[model samples]
Target chain A: MADVVKFDEHPSDTLRAGANFNLAGIDPASTPGYSGDKGAGESLLSELDGKLTQLQEQLFAESRTGGKKRVLLVLQAMDTAGKGGIVNHVMGQMNPQGVQFKAFKAPTPEEQSYDFLWRIEKEVPAAGMVGVFDRSHYEDVLIHRVHRWADAVELDRRYRAINEFEARQTAAGTKIIKVMLHISRDEQQQRLLARLEDPSKRWKYSGNDLKERAFWDDYMDAYQAAFERTSSEHAPWHVIPANKKWYARIAVQQLLLDALNGLALQWPVPEIDVDMERELVRRS
Target chain B: MADVVKFDEHPSDTLRAGANFNLAGIDPASTPGYSGDKGAGESLLSELDGKLTQLQEQLFAESRTGGKKRVLLVLQAMDTAGKGGIVNHVMGQMNPQGVQFKAFKAPTPEEQSYDFLWRIEKEVPAAGMVGVFDRSHYEDVLIHRVHRWADAVELDRRYRAINEFEARQTAAGTKIIKVMLHISRDEQQQRLLARLEDPSKRWKYSGNDLKERAFWDDYMDAYQAAFERTSSEHAPWHVIPANKKWYARIAVQQLLLDALNGLALQWPVPEIDVDMERELVRRS
Candidate 1:
């Protein structure tokens, strides 16, 4: 049996709410809280699966019984930082009924006409759901900042808007988990090259990805600014070094596990009289 | 290694659209088209996982590149018939990004105000996606007939409306797989009792389930009426005997596999200049 990995300090604590956090300072290949090789990390993830499923079901049960709590996992990452992999391998473990997934692409004509958060607010998870945003409202700040689509004043205004938006959601009982899957520029190049070489993966590649690569430093600066501005006690930002796919997967899973664990979810008490219902079933 | 299970006649063929179909005549406990025991059936399901994943990814890739084809799995069943089990065990194996899951409850006031298909139309799978409906528009006819909520004329109109709705979706490139998970009344009684006995599963139990159980024969008739009127060549209904949970799971998995296989999906060819992009990526 693989020894259960325990962390004296939670992965969330190590990764969350950086005051003077430097995105460039973290090594993309490092596994922060896990003391394991790839094999051990993979085994640990399999172990976490059962616990995650149970917690999610309990959360979903709460929803059915008029619980308002929900979780939003905001995943902001560079291309090939394994956002899709995390969604498939991690969120996919739970009942898909309880998972609402939306991948926000560039704004359409109608979408651009509305506030950035307009399209986002429409997709918020209902009571007792885990909503996964592949790329989110953060993009308005990140890409828009790097490309100078919005002036500095407008960009600064977005930061406040985001803070207020998240605060409002938090007040409404949304547990927000914001993560930046940190990857080195070199790692992205290798992964892009791999996609280019493999015909099956070529659908994910675009010349626009390379064009964006030229703005790497600008993107990083924008991310740093966004993190400093938006990281709050209610919703904090966790920067996971994601050069190693296995580590990123487990680390993100652990962050979600920590969040659900904090909810102290009880199986909602049976609302119906069990004895009476059982008798009726038996008679039927 | 588990030997791959090959069916000379697909499970879809054995379980689909019947002119003389009798729901009561079919044995709920029978595992049609599958000659394996529970262990073997499970092993075969595991084997089907990789192929399903690959096919779903190809379908999703097609969606990304402007392919409009999609699949919708419509599941209608009596309470405790393992519809949730099939979703958790089978559909959960695919990428959540590509799977749109909706569990329709009794229509709310807003939903009731519109034509039944209005709510359902809004949830249809986009291009290259698989949409699963736990209980669907069929309920308007089933429960309405059982409870006398609608007169015979209204029910007849609903049948025509359903047929036209499905035909329109089919013409719009939606491959519809309609299924009824048939379970014996005895099996349902046992399952409901089991839920009542297990504290952890009590949330899934309800007093209303027993009330519905009292109307078993009427429901079977409603289901029979539905299968007859709405089973079209473009969209056929398949009734699977679901007494054995393992068999139902693998049977549903196989049905999905057959639908995807019929598509004969090819990997979407890369739209970008591969050589130029590769050079750019290498330089970056």
Candidate 2:
């Protein structure tokens, strides 16, 4: 028999299984650094920026003619895993008028009383607008998993629910991009300790944070399980390794560009009468 | 006696004040267009960017050193003004690692019941971090002022309270910069009308926004009063012209650099021994 290539055995071939890259497995020496992909990433980013700007102008024009679409991005992660950093850098290139951001937190009585998605639903971007969430509904999985706020069966159900929820949003013309920032435990400790030492940062630290830190193993187990259950084809999680912040940021920018690349938009051309154009130029 | 250089009644002095170069009210004709100051702005921005990068690095170093300081910025503006654009563009220049952002909306019942600052306080940046607010507590003065949610006397009290509140935060090492993007009503209408035309942007348009638009004059009165009452030595408001978005963004960048200029921080000197230096050079 002819020799058969075992695709699953090779790391590169494993990528065909819908995992574009294994972020955690990358080694600094072997992997191309962020600046190394600077040419392609920068080109893509600049192009995407230009497209977005032109798209916004077109949307503005269309809104005058008829209405526009909204874009939503949800970022969820463990502590010190770079959610804030990713939002800052990835969206940095876009027009602010077309963007909005909200950071979700512990719910109040009102929010708790309503459906879990109610508070978040209010924050979804308006059409032609971009909305980013620092920590999103997946917190139900991460926090609820670790805190046992929901039972095992319930947690599993919630995971499936999130997928359906995101799919519905996508159907409603909201493009959903979800990212999972992955950081090692050592990095989180360094970050937490750093937060404690800085006077400006002292307010961010609490005695309870240390107590949570002690349960690191439990959180990791929960995260791994969540990953196994919730990652889906419609709204797959991009596990971004965040030890090298700059690289991680660039990776996120590239990921966003990749997702948005399919949305081809054309700028509305200002209707120009030939005579008026000549007269306008002559006047100038 | 030598001729008085500038008497209050002198027309030349008025002309000079109108011609003031550092962004005071320059005449429309002589007001260098947005592109006019691009060269200087870019050069200054590049230099400022370098300094900011260094400041952030030092801040991060101390973030781990023990007890760190944090910085926060609050932005409040009228509708059709350029708050979102400014946030997107100027904040883009910053180092993502140490920066965070939150956009405030109508408060929940819990937020309303507690002190107004509760929801906002939870969103403050931790030490070694920078936080930006899209619309902050000033909303109470601007929106509530026009809506009559607070009576005149209560509104008057809140204005004073805001200055004191921000001053307290400033003293606590939370460097505060407040900005108000000022756009002409005509320009605002132009933008708003455009939003209606574009399908992608249609979602941002609301019938109620037009109703609010009807109270433009009232909002302006409220804004003027708010500015007069709350502009403080510790936390002054920068009123930026938004007719020109590029100019507004550049001005904001300059303001940020000016606010941060006082923090003198240095990069950790390369850990060095004479023998190690010699060995490193020899190996190279």
Candidate 3:
């Protein structure tokens, strides 16, 4: 039987017996997601490409008219939960122009001094641009919850702050897309061990990462609380099962397409008529 | 004959007396670009899908293995040069997990105090994340030059800071990809007019945009100077023609593929053998 995991439950630090088991009907090699119906789980790689292309064209039209729309994508997940893979694979399909990727790291002295959202707001997408944040402002809740760095009152205040901040963005006509990549502990161990074994990848493995891995239960609890408090209709969280990378990417593509499709954009045609074209041609 | 316009000249600002001339072997419908090469001038739409898939797979591998390569995309361009379109269209191809897009707009009060690069530094890609900066620190050179916001000494100081900043990033294993979208003055006028006619795009059309358009020469001078100073082996600029949006996207896509192909990463394999898998399956 598949290991049923809930966000609220404490994470198991050790690899559990059933944690590695694939869900029924899930193929490790094939995509691992279903839309509304199981039978409709068709290959969307092509459709994703087509939809993205159309969206790009629509957005391109917007930019040509200088009416650019900003897109902010936020990805929050647990350690070894395929956040990295999801970023790599999912964004591999984007055109470099319309997209600007900003990964917010540990706050420098300057960043820490200001509000946490200061650094994040700086990286928000400009008009007609898409911005993705690998780990976003929610860190106050996630890391703070696990480490107890912030008191309950402070944390509560932050939760409200985040909701208000995102709401402001939504009002500003910015599209907010958030995803949480979820992976099993057993799968994570397999990945961690693989990184240790490979010389090239060994550089990525740090003792600190392992140390954090030991506190998986605390982190999971933090994540659960953060998600419960933060998830909303304005910024719905897509809990992606990331053991399968292809499916996660396809799902993201679909989500983006759905959002972009709602925009209802028209391409600009040159204002010149047949007579104008002829006259311009004749003059030329 | 094609007008011999200088860098400082805007396509709209210059009114040329000429017949509608279609250069031989040039497909007007094809994305407009002067690669100076006779072949492979197709727009981004033609090749966007294929490259998106290839990159997605690579990103998945890198993310799964916890590789720490960060991809930073920098786009610079004149007004209506398709920067927004490029961001929208190009990013349409990649996975969201690995990519985070940032557009640097007018700095806030807090941002203005520090060096211009300070806000940008905070948004740099983390290990294994892709960061895109739209109208990034280069604005110090581009906009500052046109507006004369910085005296010669301050501008000179800013240039050195930028060079050092990018070099340090490259040394620290950041891959910086810079693209400049080039659009003609005629094309700019056509696009601007479209924005004025469209109510939805009116929000993006500012009186200043028109005023800025009038100072095309100054902007070009600023851009040329900026490009010459900052284009380096570590972060070379690929000048993309923006007349054909499709072509611009294609050029950027090719650049991404080339950069990623250089990494040559392998997907991690499970250490457990088939027998172990079978046993695990049976146990489950």
Candidate 4:
């Protein structure tokens, strides 16, 4: 189960979104592919942390030395689903040099005037980078659909555009991992209440979260439809059970590790005389 | 000395640029504002780390709760001067939510068409956030002048324009900390050679870095001139001796801690009814 957790490239357990997947079919609280004691979770994650960190550095180093490959971890989730925590805890373990994190808030008036992907294209991680999008172009389909902001024809055009975009990135030495953190409505309500209760966390609370919560059913429907339309061979969507924040974090890291390791990454070949450089550093 | 380092807000020690400051004036081997054992440095930083972490989290919390103030930490240096290391070590310690790190590489054709600061203005840390620029607008004067890309009059205009731009941000509730990590020419050569020797670091080696190094003296002259014209009470330029990378990291963190502490920040008042929320969470 542990090896399967680390080595499973297909993400079959959570890759439900595109393959006749149903949002209602998956249990958010259940931990997939692992039946370990909950107390052992942190230690399990720490082990993965070490391996992933090394691979990430190598990915960065390889990219520096003419490795064209890069990875983009596209994260989309509802409020209180722990997107920030995943960034801080999972992506944080990697060196910031190699990680390009862009948090997509509401579109600025300037951004709104451009095509939806205009801002996104500017922010994609460069070669040898592990780029993370806190929210991404997916926002167009999710919120735009929930709010009836897009007409059916325009929405279809966006779906086609997204597929082509990801395909282009894939062909250009990019590996795309799109994940939607799946959390139960009950768990979200509990988390929101918890945030409000703590003085420090109260600041994280937003009235907008509540306003959006009222449209929970509609958002879920939108997500289900989005994955079916946009998910493809190049960049498939994985809906992780997120009520257990640990599971979501661990699973996400495993997915990333698998992606990096799959590249058969090699350290760059030396261009200068190592012995001479060592002597110079020693003298300096 | 430690307290002095933490409290020194003038930035005059490292701000030696223009006609007044010389690249030869300071010792890269020396640890300015610190007298402690080099081995004990991490422990000392660990001590300051606690205070700064709390303050950063509070700044983030406060911002989320409607605090208008934010921080912009601008980092500039020649190649291999450890700009990325500072971001990974110093800024990485803070919560990623509150830290916006942007590495500005050579301008794209699109970026070149617009004025330089347009891209920079877009990336300024939002309210209650801490912004770190890996290489910034200074590149325009530093590289553009070194290469004679801009004529003398145009360079002078860019200096005034940058000053006005930062002054505007200062008036708008942003605390700007502009830092230049200074390394000696000998040290830079040693570091460059070391990168060439190490396969993992080879990818980080850009042929362009060598191209820039060939014009080192011109770049230094450009930097001195820039500081003379642009350093102000609003956004003072700081030059930390970076050969001892740890000392540089600690000092930069100290500068940031000092900036955040100076805000006299308060945790935002509770918006939701605390007791009611507590009761609700307890019920859930």
Predictions in order: chain A TM-score: 0.97, 0.76, 0.80, 0.93
Give the Cα lDDT of each candidate.
0.90, 0.61, 0.63, 0.81
Backbone clashes in model 1, listed as residue pairs: none
Best by lDDT: 1
CAPRI docking class of candidate 3: incorrect
Q: In model 2, what is the error at residue B261, expressed in angstroms?
A: 1.2
- Candidate with top DockQ is 1
lDDT of 4 by residue, A1-284 (tens): 23222323335444546677787888989787766544456666777777887788888777665788999999999999999889988887777777888889999999999999899899888898999999999999999999999988989999999998899889989999999998988898889888876766777776678778878999999999888998897788889989998778877887887788888887777476567645544544
Per-residue alpha-carbon lDDT of candidate 2 for residues B52-153, written as tens digits (9 for 90 to 100): 655665665565446356667777766657776666567656655556777798898878998676777788777767778889888888889888999989
Q: By descending TM-score, how would the candidates be arranged?
A: 1, 4, 2, 3
lDDT of 3 by residue, B176-249 (tens): 88877777766777777666666545445555566677677788777666766777767776556667775666
Give i-RMS (Å) per prediction.
0.9, 12.5, 9.2, 4.1
Those runs of model 1 whose alpha carbons end farther than 4 Å from true positions after fitting are A1-8, B1-8
Candidate 4 lDDT, B226-271, residue by residue in tens = 8888888788888788898888888888789879989998767766
DockQ of each model against the real complex?
Answer: 0.86, 0.10, 0.16, 0.29
List candidate 2 stretches off by more than 4 Å: A1-41, A51-91, A94-254, A258-284, B1-57, B196-203, B267-284
Decreasing DockQ order of the candidates: 1, 4, 3, 2
lDDT tens per residue, model 1, A1-284: 55656554688989875688787788898888778778777888889899999999999999888999999999999989999999999998989999999999999999999999999999888889999999999999999999899998998899999999999999987999999999999999999999988878999988788888899999999999898889988999999989999899989999999999998888988767778787778888
Tens-digit per-residue lDDT, A180-264, candidate 2: 6667666776776665455444445444555566667777677666666656666656555566665566556555554554445
